[model samples]
Target: METLTNDKATLEVQLSTQQKLIANMREELGICKEHKAMAESQSESRGAHLLELKAQLEDAVLSLEAAERRMHDGELMRRRLHNTIQELKGNIRVFCRVRPMSSLEQVGADPDIQPALDFPPSDDLLSAGIILSAPSRDGAATLSKHVFAFDRVFTPEASQDAVFEEISELVQSALDGHKVCIFAYGQTGSGKTFTMLGSEEQPGMIPRSMRQIFESSQGLRQQGWELSLQASMLEIYNEEYKDLLSSKKLSGSNKSTKEGFGSQQPSGEIKKHQVVHNPDGSTTVSELTVVDITQASQVDLLLAQAMEKRSVGCTALNEQSSRSHMVFTLRLEGVNEAKGKRVSGVLNLIDLAGSERVKDSGAAGLRMKEAQAINTSLSALGDVIVALGNKQPHIPFRNSKLTYLLQPCLGGDAKTLMFVNVAPNIQFAGESLCSLRFAAKVNACEINHRKKG
Candidate 1:
């Protein structure tokens, strides 16, 4: 019995041990399953992360390719536009430059003295036109608002560089062996001089143009081009031509004689020259001084000398008024060694005498005559421009000395650009309107064919 009891105890003890072992195994199995489940979740998360990374990389690559394609398309478009502009002949383009108020004009003068020029909003792309409202008289309703449109309208705040950028293409046309003419026209004190021949610090169209031509010629040399540049300066005072570069002097004082056909007799030989027409429709003045220029600084000096010799006088309209029309001609001759081709181009830079009203100019003696001559020439220029705009069969080219001299630019295949400078002052509104109207007429004229050499 004792053995049987001990055997039972041993059996019970073994069974208890076995049951504890099974419970331990169950807990271990649960821990293994939980760890396996956790491992599978981590693997799935990593797999998804890798797929997302791959998608992002592919997207980045596609975006890069798209940007490259856009850049290529932009480059191609730019080249096409450049070629088109080069092939197309530019018409007579008119640009309006509005002069800022002078120090005198801005001083504690009456507010009414300010111009009625209405500038467009800053963000407006189509704001290149100007609205000139008639002055308010006795606080009455304004008479009219003259809206003038131009190819370009430069505000008073426009920089000299900005103005030149618009016309630099025309300068390039001359370098490409096309005749180019640029002239500034306006009333006295309307900033024609400032636009054409700005101050030393500013340096206007004439100086900038010479530098551009010089730089461009250097680049062309790489293409086997040999360039020759010649410049001549002349002024028409009272309808006569005076060589500003001539060494001959007037008989009396340092003041040169008023040169023109129907003007007062010069004390000495006025260095007279005759205008001859070539069979090819080119015109040249006999014995015109043409200086070969290698550097732009030489042009600066030449312009300075001409300005010193220009007829300027104080008038009620302008304190330092230019009393005559000045024309500076740059002749460019280019030879390409590789092509064995030669090209000659003419660039005419003109600063027209401001048209002044006799009553406003308060002229006496010689100034009165100057006013008459200037008005007459400007009137004739108007008639020629009007006739040209009207597409008249016989455009009046022999109306006045100014028009006659500009016949090639006005009537021929030359590319012409005119800068209509307008004063932004109430006192000069009428004159500005007239000047703008004349420019509008010029802009309307169309030249069918342009000679590219």
Candidate 2:
């Protein structure tokens, strides 16, 4: 019986050991199920967080698109506002500039010369009016005071930068897609050329305008605008138009072959270049050479080339006189591809031949003919301006090549600014008076309406 009891005890021990192992295995399986449940919950939370992040990303994308649209709209508004400001100032404006007398002119000069020209001391009248004193024709001792008013008047002390500051706004208008014309009008020694084409140290309007256009175009690129510029230079000499940038030579002419002024050949052969007016108010000359202006430096080279070929001669009134009206045109074409918009603008910078009398200029033969031609064209220009001012039905644009070529800029919705240069000397008092009077008339004349390009 004791042996049987011991055997039972051994079997009981083996059963208990097996039962303990089973319990341990069941407990381990329960722990695994809890871990699996936690893992599933974590996966669900992670999926929910991913969806939230996706929604936020979608919102950000939409916001970016909206901002871009608003930016585009703002740019359009800016252009409109900018143009409006320019129009309010004036569609056509005139500024008078008096050049300081050179040391040579001042040397041995008459002491009474100081009374010839005077600028008002008051700031209110300083830029608005100029007083000119000249001996009356009736009596040498009797002085006549002629007071003139204009849009703006620059004194002899005004620097090139100061002059350009007033003109920078108009230059900006050209980039905003408007036809702009800035021309200098005065006598030979009145500093018209100097004001328009200043030295390297003191750059003038053309260079400053080009540099502004280029710099502005780069800034406009951020607003989705791409601008391209084309430049053309021409000279109107002896009632005929010559391409200053032309490579052709005048056959059988005594003039330098390098100079491209198309004079009549010995065989009576004449090259005719027609000025065609486009429906878009842009003028084109047949056989005119157009250069792509990629940089401002290119325009400098062109100006140098034109100056070399330009017709200039010495006279008693002034040495190195400009015998031709040089017209430099810059065509601006802008495209906003994203907005499906396009703009075309033109800027005409003209340096007109000085206006002087034959007696004063002391011209004979060829020089006399050139002086007559210059005077005739200038007369034609004056006639056109008067007609426009009077609102005449038929403007005399076709009277001269200079007038006809500038028809688009002078009339219609184009922006025009005239710089009436003057010489601050007693000798040029009469010419200065005439110029100031003409400019005053121009400033008083108002255009009917304007439409931006």
Candidate 1 deviant stretches above 4 angstroms? 1-90, 111-115, 121-127, 136-143, 250-271, 449-453
Pairs clashing in candidate 1? 239-260, 240-259, 240-260
Residue 145 deviation, candidate 1, in Å? Answer: 1.6
Residue 376's lDDT in candidate 2: 91
Overall lDDT per candidate, in order of appearance: 0.77, 0.82
Give the per-residue lDDT of model 2 (tens digit) for 68-141: 89998887798788877767667788899998879997786888556577877545632487899877878677
Candidate number of the best lDDT: 2
Candidate 2 residues lying further than 4 Å off, grouped into runs, are 1-50, 110-112, 121-127, 250-270, 449-453
Error of 2 at 430 (Å): 1.4
Would you estimate the TM-scores of all the predictions?
0.73, 0.85
Model 2 has an lDDT value of: 0.82
lDDT of 1 by residue, 193-307 (tens): 8889898999999999998999988767855679988787889899987778754564221232111111222455444656655665556674455677899999888888898
Best by TM-score: 2
TM-score of 2: 0.85
